[model samples]
Target chain A: MIRLRAKISSSRGQSTNISHKVGTWSFSAFVILLLTVIFFPGLFAPYDPLELDVINRLQAPSKAHLFGTDEGGRDIFSRVLYGTKDSVGASMVIVLMASGTGTILGAIAGWFGGRIDFYLMRMVDVFLSFPYLVLAMALAASLGRDMRSAILALILVWWPSYARMVRGQVLSIKERLFIRAARTVGASNFQILFWHIIPHTYRTVGVRASMDVGYVLISLTGLSFLGLGAQNPSPEWGLMISNARSYVLASWWYSVFPGIAILLVVSLFIYAADRFSGAER
Target chain B: MAQLLQILDVNKTFKSGNSKVKACQEINLTIGEGEVVGLVGESGSGKSTLANLVLGLEKLDSGSIKFEGVELEKLLKDKSKSFRREVQAVFQHPLLSLDSRKTIAWSIAEPLVINKIGNSASRKARVLELLAAVALDEGTASKYPSQLSGGQLQRVNIARALALEPKLIICDEPVSALDVSVQAQIVNLFLDIQKRLGVAMLFISHDLAVVRHISDRIAVMYAGKIMEIGDTDDICESPIHPYTQALLSASTFTEESDEGREKLKLFRREEVPQKGCPFSTRCPHAIALCREEEIKIQSFASNQESSCLRAQEIFPNLAKK
Candidate 1:
């Protein structure tokens, strides 16, 4: 056992660990990219997202405008960059809300079992019955169309998925010896849920949240596509796409660039989530 | 030392639909301070159920368990947490006993933190001290349970159990999953802890060799009832009950060669029957009464008894063979 420990410790120190390096790089890059879009949107965009130039209207890519202009002469490139603050921002809120609600609810259901689990899961099933986009649209429509409403709608629609995931994880974790050990140590039910069961759920649910962000972004964009999301003149990527759709044939750069912006963010999230799972292993 | 733990006619039954299972039947025993008691049994013998009962993890259908004269059930009411701090357990598997994602320090310090033992720095210091006490070094504090060796993890488990300075530790097959060499290290670690700390224990295992090595007294169980209870050496040297003799004969190391192993089969036979004596169907001396009699515990000596009808007549003959 002593010799085996020595071997493991020494091997862990070697530089040839390719997977360890790749995971670190991928995670750091995701953080840097997200922060640039979130906190320094102006610094990254070359042109003002809302700046209008009459002569540049429906123009194809030129030397001045890298992503060309939309029907209203606004720089598509700038709008897409600025648009991230809302699209990604709302998606982040939705992911947080869903994962938080789901994990807590699921943990309770799985941990306690019996009647609590039965009724709570039935509620989850009711929420899950609605199609993701339709439910978000219905919620956004009922609440009235705006960024905050859209985010609220998305949160309401998405939390059940997290709850289901969390509850399954909680059920399995609750049976573990550590949980029983915690009980044996006189840790209160609150402590066992927060300290023991919740930590285990975090490992499982953290990976799911990152992936869920990509899905939530797609769903939020779908709401915007149906005219139930961000309205005119807003810099959100989804609303920008809606406004630029008419000029697609004449100048594909407008809607295409914002479309690609959504794609890039979603793909980055998925990639980061995958890398996170690998790093944990 | 006074009796640290006492169980009086404890019973447990599970009802599922129309059927019922008597998981534990009239279990009674006493454990003195710092004493190690072994409850040896096959699967489904209610040893684990008894452990759960003492821990207040399961409610008994009848009877009561007292720790220093306080009823276990009453102690479990609102202050189950305090009751737990006094009585700890080391489960069968190390992998299953520690949360996989948490660091060894967090796992050990959690109970202390929840019980509000000390400040963060003090808790960390205490955790490190616990790690050191379990023979692990300072580096292990940050390592996750999955990264630790089985024996190291078991030692960490022991450390966690000792963190609250529990008066009694119930070890349910603590070393069963480990390799033979690793098992001995864990067993020795347990023995050392018991000796230095003087904490009472109810050690549950199916391995008689391990039971013999650690237990001050042994309780052999079959079909949810204790067949024999006595001093460890007495149980090993002179097992009175036919089932006890059958259990002893069936274990390895008793017969030398394959021929002797074949010859030993006469003493070691099949499973105990479902009803009556439980061992009646397989007993060579079985008569109509042996099959019809509802076996009850009979006294052989003080603090020693065998629940076997034919114990007196068969004791001398079995010892000779």
Candidate 2:
């Protein structure tokens, strides 16, 4: 009876494992499709994203216009495709810049942990105390209303969490016996920090960085929706949604398609990051 | 033989809240060029602490350690590359001593690379030569530390330590973590390295038999104090200190009765005294005077020294012999 029960559980586990594999494969394919749209929007987009057609403005979805037309009569499908480069690409850059800054600062702070650590961590605490979006919005508003300012503000707000994480990782890695061995071999403080300590932090930092890309995407589009990021007629997903807010009841396709694009890309990135960190363990 | 390293009246105290543990107290020893001095003591007897002091890993609370006639503090303050090249260490945990992410070749070549001795191609050749010296195959160089066995990783550690052709290598319980069968092999490797490279060593271990097998001179420590130190055979054959005698007897298996073993036992239920001799509470022959007076290591002969108060009375024939 015990063996029969064990057999039932084992088969259940096997079925879940198969489902997980399928989920991971499909997620990867969707990410690849997203990347293709980002890099070469012209391949999938029939109409030019910036072409103006005042007479056909706010057209509902039909055979000619698959995703219909927007406030400026720009094809919604083409705009979402072209906007992938601006929205998703900006988030990627923010994550990269934030992680790069965080890793270096955290390593230095953890390695030389007297007054420098005290001050740097306190500064990080100050940055972390505020709600990220509110602080980012204020900074973006103050820096002037553009995509560059929004990206810069988000990069500033996003880095503290990474800095705190990498610092924690460095503190642990520095205590490992291998680090002491490195010191015995005449490795300088800088050499030990970059070569010995930082290399060990890559796994945790990479996992965190992958996950941050998704969160940064949400925050970036949120900023654009509020007019703090990419301005009018830029074909940005959030800007397109903001433009469609008045005509949503009359022409639902205008806002719904770009919203779907945002949902798909963000959820896919987050799901992929979850799987990536799970596989690491 | 010229002195390669000298530790003079060094002290280190670790404080936790209000209590303090004196890890090393007035430690005075020297390792001459190409000499192997085995330091045997029980756990918490400050053998590794002394190793750390000599390596300049920990801050010295008091006194001085001189290497090649230069103060250790001065060398470390200058961040002297030559001093680092001259002294190296092999820790007890072989696997933990190596960076797991790095290949064996990279770990071994780290010292040479840091010291800027050779370019990449020459460093690769030198790593192969070092692998050969430690009896590891050339293919082992590409493998990660986790892939290697405890014994093989230890050999890699020894190779890395020997990379700069250091004048002294501190082996702190290097083989204690290995299997008993593998222990002998690693000990033999240390002996082989010492013989071929002529590198001085401060070999620290709790196992007296292992220490006696490879050391030229042996120092027996009890509770952070050197109970006895002499030529390996002198201390082994005639152990004047009660603690040294107990250590020697404990390492060697005998068919003695329970009562006999009880007489040979070193530990007593008495509290360790705050001052004077550290072993007085544990000493089987401890008297009232043993607990009252401050004990110092006194020379009994040209090469032998003991801290025990009753060294002369316990072993009267030691001086005559």
Candidate 3:
């Protein structure tokens, strides 16, 4: 556990800013409860995600199925509920993998410089030259239309941005005295990077990761919508949207609810990122 | 005297495309054991470059440096950990010198932990002991560097430097960033540590008065070359080199005010030449020979040396002035 010393005290502007935002119960509750809704969907949802009812097809909100049923007689409410878990889980994994790989590689490059910095930055440039969507599609197409391929593609495309962010932070941070001080104390390269530089970079990394959650979620949904992710009948929200888009001309509820779920989750991530970054500054 | 530290004819020049930028000239100095050698010069005087070279942070273009009997270059050639363990550095900015993420306890213990000197329990104990030695409370060990004052942070830096039990501590303007009162406290701490440990110190500063107080010997540097080197009292009372005398006259001494302000100026303050004497442009007494010829170290008064063409001629004029 990192024992954080609140150096900028209550009297400081940062503390006041943190206090002002934290006092709003709605925002705080949304952030905390949103995680629970994503992680433990079964406890929160009224119906089983996979359950279907032919009789309730195209029906609006009622006592039995609050969100009504889709064109194929599947419950819109249950699928959206379960979709939260899968969507968040996949995006979280993508972010963790990308950020982890990127930060490590970036730290090595920035701290070592010379050949390491030159090579790693060039690699990032190569990846960045391709459009993210095109690269993800290409990867998903080649690897077969599976959830894993889509995730792998997204991670591959996403890592370069993190690498760039981390490298920028590292360049400035490595020049700091603590790193030199670490060297003066006979600290090995590994120890200095992990123990000294990483923690300093993490503040910016944390904010970036929080903000990237929205982007990752959008990318995952886009892939699923393109039929390159989460196979049909999986109760994934993006697949539900893809399957429901035709019926939206008649039964509007089919597409609207899932879209709202996506919006709320994305908005929450963006808002949370804003708050976290604000507090840090 | 048996040399504790010796830097011989070191020259370093940086390259930019076709041209070269001379950062340090052919410099030589020998400091003895248990002595505080003041490396005094203004900003961009190559004082820091020389310090960095001695610490093995930067490679010397030519010449060699030795600490005791061991060659500094040879020591740095293989394992620098031992070199760091023997010769530590305290940087200019105390705030920057410490890890903000770590607690004071952890930062101080880092050196001990890195060197693998004593196990976990003993290291923790040692950190607390060091904190106390620096006149800080044990409670401060758990606090981060940002929580402490500037003076407190510098003391922590000093404590960290001494943790490796280094033979020499290269303090690069360690007290310049602090309040004048705090400067005294830290300087006194250096003196106290030197008295207790008998550690040779390469005390680098632009402040002549502070250097005079702590140093046994002084070396005045300009544009990376040592203009004069002698015992502290000898250099202060009767400076042989023109640059050294000009520097002394300008500074406000503890005993007297800037009484000779009119005479306390040097004119050779142009951009340091690519080669030859860096102070030549500023030297009011520079002759035609000063421009073409690089001044070499010439013996003068007892245990004193001046790097000037007209050291003998300038000595009487400097004393009379």
Query: For every model shown, what is its TM-score relative to the native structure?
Result: 0.89, 0.93, 0.92
**Model 3, TM vs. native:** 0.92
Residues B1-321, candidate 3, lDDT per residue (tens digit)?
A: 568889989999888999776778888888888789999998988888888888877889999998877888677665646887988889899999998889999989999888889999999999988998899998999998889999999999999999988888999999999999999999999999999999989999999988998999999998878899899999998888888888887777746555535565666357776556778888877787888897787776477888888877866644321
Using TM-score as the measure, which candidate wins?
A: 2
Q: B98, model 2: CA deviation in Å?
A: 1.3
Docking quality category of candidate 1 according to DockQ thresholds: medium
The best-first sequence of candidates by DockQ reads: 2, 3, 1
Q: How close is candidate 2 to the true structure, as a TM-score?
A: 0.93
Q: What order do candidates take by TM-score, descending?
A: 2, 3, 1
Estimate, for each residue in B39-75, the C-alpha lDDT of model 1 and write its tens digit.
9988778889999899988889899999989888778
Q: Which fraction of the native contacts appears in each prediction?
A: 0.87, 0.82, 0.84
Q: Cα miss at B35, model 1 (Å)?
A: 1.8
Q: Please list all clashing residue pairs in model 3, or write none if there are none.
A: B267-B282, B268-B281, B268-B282, B268-B283, B269-B282
Candidate 1: stretches off by over 4 Å: A1-24, A271-281, B14-21, B250-274, B316-321
Second chain TM-score, each model: 0.90, 0.95, 0.94
Candidate 3: misplaced stretches above 4 Å? A1-31, A71-74, B17-19, B77-80, B254-263, B273-276, B316-321
Flag the better candidate by DockQ, 1 or 2: 2
